[model samples]
Target: MGKKCNAPPECVPDYSKDEAYLKTVIPTRIALFESIKGQQLPHRQSISGNPIKYSSFTIPLNYSGMIILRNGSVKDGKKWISTPLDIAKGISKDWGENALISKVNGVLWDMLRPLEGDCEPKLFKFDSDEGRDTFWHSSAHILGQALEIEYGCKLCIGPCTTRGEGFYYDAFYGDLGLNEDHFKQIASGAAKAVGEKQPFDRIEVTRGQALEMFSENKFKIEIINELPDDKTITVYRCGPLVDLCRGPHIPNTSFVKAFACLKASSAYWRGNRERESLQRVYGISYPDQKSLKDYIARLEEAKKYDHRELGKTQELFFFHPLSPGSCVFLPHGARIYNKLVEFIRNQYWKRGYQEIEKQEFGLKPMNCPGHCLIFDHRVRSYRELPLRLADFGVLHRNEASGALSGLTRVRRFQQDDAHIFCREAQIKDEVKNALEFISSTYEIFGFTFDLKLSMRPDKYLGDLETWEKAEADLTEALNEFKKPWEINEGDGAFHGPKIDISVSDALNRKFQCGTLQLDFQLPSRFNLAYSAEDEAKKERPVMIHRAILGSVERMLAILLEHYKGKWPFWLSPRQAIVCPVSEKSEPYALQVKDQIHEAGFYVDVDTSDRKIQKKIREAQLAQYNYILVVGEKETEAGTVSVRVRDTRDLRDESIEGLLKFFRDEVAAFR
Candidate 1:
């Protein structure tokens, strides 16, 4: 039996009536002076004849502490004097030469932006995540400064994004058209700025002042007009260049040791097609020369894997102006696509997932709706708690032409999509299983991926309580797996929390390939439920939406780039090409090819009347994995001379042995 509740005073013992109880209930607070008795305050020094005052409050000396200025003055108890330059210097000194100084609060400001009124501050070291973003953002500004000096382009906007290699900026060049030819000049300019060690000077100006300063630039003027009159605009000045920007730039431009402009394309102002077009330059910047060299090497490696180039070389796929976004997969490309679908389908079959086919049109951009319909088709019981469904369905979205590139962005693609319907208690295990599957699949492709947990968005479908529960479930699953994941705040799907897997290819380029989402809203939206063990009651089962490979076309492109068209044995479109030494051995080569074809190898025989060297050269250019050479000596022994791609080494092996070897390699890929 529970005791009855009482009022606050009644619940507490009366000191006069119960003195012993009073002693146990109350605890005295420690005196502030005694609590910090053995501590020491940070030392302060004058800068440029300005006597900067620091906190007198005793703080732990062993562990560094920062004096944050919350209020305007040092006299205010809330205000703590700390200069930005001091913080940057402290970090750089403590973290060593590789340490980067990142600005906070829209000021990659000079390490010297004095702590003003009360504000929250954080110190960044070399490895801190915030520090890296700040470092990259500051690099963008340095690039902007260089552009201004070299080309005198009116800067519109430059921001760091998680695409390409590093950062990019959209600048409007009045009457001066910029293209790829200017990349070298821009890179040279940026390198010059990096050498200057220009400190990013941050200043807060009134809206009127901002308008006056950027009056000559229409884009900036338009941006300023949209801001409120009371708003304060921040500007970052480097060398002779000044631009209205809100940034936490690096301590100085010297930290940006290497930079390069990759390409230039047209972008609409503010990403709106209706707005004026601006020339956008894409570039990547690194901290050191080694990183820059590695990036260039990777770029060269990536060129080999370029899907468009591979398509042309292999005669696998083609794009036409008639149907811009739609791709025409040639016979070879179609075969690979079919093979991938079959592979994923086999996995689904072994996992007890019901393969479902649904209408392509009228389907939402997502695959969840079709899965919902399948879930509704049957009255599930608690005994069948986790029902898995998989699909390899074609999906289309309205993507602007400007947004499409290579295989990264496309309108039509197939998704290796699946949905798991499970009881609330089974959410953790189901999510873990999905993650394991995604990990294993990526590992097989020689990819390293990172996980990210995305939370609810600004506009969400469910109540706070539901969202909290959903988020908790996801967090619990992530914890159970013990995987390192970064959080993407307010960027989840409309209905739930999701885990996004970003995988890095051979070029060290990260692409979003896998996703696992916990959705309670979707089941309820579709009125889906399963019967309980009690026989009468029915409860809505939670839906876990997932996709191991987001799109077939995109993944193919990534693979093409990752391997540089030198696909592994099984994935190679042309696995082996047979070249005869002369017309004398042509008949034998054809016989060998037929035998290999019967064994399921993609074998081609060079029957053209050309020199044996020319044939080998052609096969090499085609990137065939194996080149088999046959001549009078090889026919007498009933063996062929095999040459592996990308190498000159030749080995003699019997026809049967060669067939066995190639089969084993292909099996390993599977």
Candidate 2:
């Protein structure tokens, strides 16, 4: 019954149509079988004119598979495999250039180079780390060409940087030195090189050929002579210039669409201080125009927030060449600094932490030794497992003058430091509490921060097992907090694992402000322990070193730049300025100032015989929050005309009412 139904209803085709359907289906089925057979077939074949035989197959990027040769030898392989030009030719017959590009790690490598063996390949885009380095390295060659054309400078070494925007090259500028004035000429020359759109041609040469090519430049010759005998020498050339380099550069010079000269400095050759100094020219380039614009805007904004300039303008701090790396905080600056200390002291007091003073010039470079002295002063019990001690201690380090910057890098600075002596089992909880304190303090300053866990350095002091346990404890603490943090491998202190908090300001510049360090070695070094509940047991207590604000002076500088000299009412040294309209109202203004002073405000009466507008302008320039104008109308009405800074609106309110308003604002700190 089913066969009959197909013949009439399901199979509606006539005899002729049935034959056509069969013909189409049979050929497709046969073709599928043939294609599958071809894929399984061995590819050992010789081209018409090629001297070597080759094998070929389709492979995906980064694929892991096995290749079985005709000789019964089996080899594990990835998408990338080491082969000579003959094998690549055979593979090229089946696949296109895209496969080759993926095989060589997305690099524009030479097609004839032999692939010797199988390995894992990494595909790269323009934004990948390796890709960016390759692009910038090519750009450095272009820069060398431009410099040669413009200044006739002898290039020594140019390399891409890991931390900064782009690359820098060291060169000798003959007798004339390169400075800011030469940037325009160098940029113009670079633009010409970009316009030429020349390819970066790579050439391999022997030792004799390299020696003859760079004989005129002694620096290049010296570097070449030191190379190992088995190493291959290569040179990259763009336009009319060539240099000795080991390169994986971009295809051509036209990729350098945007460029700029950042700075010029003097640096010793190979970073050796005893060697002769060469002129180092720094530059940055981008493939897109918008990236270049964004970089320039950030640089300009940084100039506005340059702490050195703001410190001088606000009369907050100063540095002298005699002291080099040390800063001298003025009286006004000291007022802000001491107030911050008081505020933190109050915080510690509320948190049940004991405040203690430490010696400024101690035997060690850190406060750990002094804290040990206090910890050992008296016998402690197991009940005091997490004893917190606070200090505002000054520290100094021997820093070179060349490494000094504004407030970010200084020799002498004070740290709002604390140490927690706790049992080994309480390490995670103590670290979590410390992090919470740091986050809350940063929130008060309206800053967003990131955490970094720094591991032990090469020159560490503790045993491997102890360091492992300390690292594990820190990892547990971070895991409990459940916050994302970056790892700075091999960058911690000698004796511990540490966490650094880098806070970002309004302009998106980061400043290092807080740190939490775990120290097991220091307690052992100082021989610190507490008696356990079991009368016979005494165990070493772990030490936690933490700081909310690394340095008061540095924090002040950052705040000044962050707020642009406009401090909040509570933090401002001078909260309000009372300016009398004329000499007649001076007495009333003085009385009003006294009233505000009595209300617990910092107020000053401007007794200068200048015009009222000049006095208001001066008050605004000083960044005072409020300017109280006392004239005949104000005195008669028992009101003061209040002119708020950075605004044009004026409010007429009674003296008592105005004082109350400031008190409320100061309390809120808005």
Candidate 3:
């Protein structure tokens, strides 16, 4: 979860509380939204209201401006009056009809949000990430409306999935429990909202104003209180629902042509079990029915490869209520985990994965804090400028319970965490090397990934100039690699800018499993320094924080689904199994299995009473990468018949030759 970060992060119903205190939840929430909208709205205005305070630009009478489109073309527009949608319409009817979101000066601007001044605007369709997020975000509002109208449940946080497939909303229904039986009614309500063509409108208010607006809903109130008093809060109203959100949602509800309620489950408020329990309903919507149908098909396919399900069936891992958010890796799962750690440790040691300079980092349970302590322990020379320190120690985090989905987000996990200390001039080379290492590791696992330069967030801890230099170095390293990448504005850690790496699995789902971050704050805090060439000079070194396999547990989950439980040979716990043709060959099969085991690979002999074909089929179904069959002929020749999983093509080889092949395959990391 820490690497690239999860997109939108999920529960159950309660009492069958006889009647579950099924009191009708009043329409106060909607009335409140309308009340605020009324106060915020200018009388006698249209859906796109004229701004009273949001705009910083002062418009002259009939003020006219030009919108610089992405293609270097300019269109006549009026400040505080013309919107991106207006410009899109002028560009083409197709762009106007399908534009889901817009970007103004690199900021995600809602299509309906008015242009403040002469500015550059880029329109995006559903094909782009921004557009898809806006679409799904709006759909969540629709779902929230339906849930409120149908069950009077209190709506909570709702957003699109990490992959932009769909969205889900978490809500509290008191003791009232929910099941699939309610999906049809929910869908009906959602469809009704789409038919209404309600436009999504945004408004900003002070803390007191926001607190008053959501006074009737304790959940929204709780969220409101979490914000700083001086912060201006923005709320988006769609139909009767005015949600607490920072949004650039779709222009209106009519955009969703197809909608469905996928499933319902139980959740805890804010994902805390100690808090109020809630109901979580998942849903999806699309502009057209065909895309919805295609998505439904893909969902079914994805379920077959769901890591949680495969983990159970493959006897790899399991989760229990007693240890929520953490997985219990079985022996087989442990084998894979150990191998991954061992593999990475060996790679860094051999390849000299290091920074251009050296300094030690400090620790506050994380690797950096401890590494700093070691560096500061004694006076250090410039010769060891690039000190590479790696940690395999377990790190724990108090992740939200509802947010925990399989191993992707967990309370307990191990990271391939390491730190590099180098001189300022060496930053780019260190970053470039880290990028290359990331690519090589992903290539070994057959993964496709997206690279992003996450910029300094709103709140940061270093001098502006230092932050800028770190960002520039990372940017240069990315350009040097010559790969396509994008910027994730205001998405960096508070300490510094970072290079985020999101690995895409077989289903094209993205997981943030690796990142290389440049830090100035921590190094400064620890006062880590090294002797320079100048006899009296002591220079502070920069620290590069990195973790390639951000949670071995999470990566295993991604790999599980990516391969659909058929692990690649090197990573497979059940590398091979020998099946005896009959009692006549049982002894020979056992001998072969023992020999393979002694050679340092996982192997087993199937001594069951099942026939030859049945044994082979069972072994393949169990996902043993290589299946060995021994019979009278094989026994006579000191050889075994080999069959590959999925492709049962058989080839006979001597026992010694087969072991050599197995060793090569494992060593290749294929």
**Which candidate should be chosen as best, given TM-score against the real structure?**
3
Evaluate model 1: give its TM-score: 0.76
| All-Cα superposition RMSD per candidate | 17.2, 20.3, 7.5
How close is every model to the real structure, measured as TM-score?
0.76, 0.69, 0.85
RMSD of 3: 7.5
For 1-670, candidate 2 gives per-residue lDDT tens digits of 0111223333433322235523443344334434433553333122122322224332333222223223222223322223322333334443322222223432234323333344333323344434466667777777777776666555799888644358888876544567889889889988998999876655566787777666656678778999989888877667766778877566567778898888888876666666645788888898779988997898898788687887787687898988876788886676677777877887798776888855555623577788888999888898987999888777788765666788877888878889999998888888998888888778777788877788888678878887787788888887787766755667799878899888888876677778999888888988998999985899899899988887877898788878877878777776889999999999899999999989877789999999999999999988888999999999888889999988989999888798778878755655
Better of 2 and 3 by lDDT: 3
- TM-score ranking from best candidate downward: 3, 1, 2
User: How many Å off is the CA of 437 in candidate 3?
Assistant: 1.1
Candidate 1 lDDT over 612-660, as tens digits, reads 8899999999888899999999988999999998899999999999989
Model 2 Cα shift for residue 545 (angstroms): 2.9
Of the candidates shown, which would achieve the greatest lDDT relative to the real structure? 3
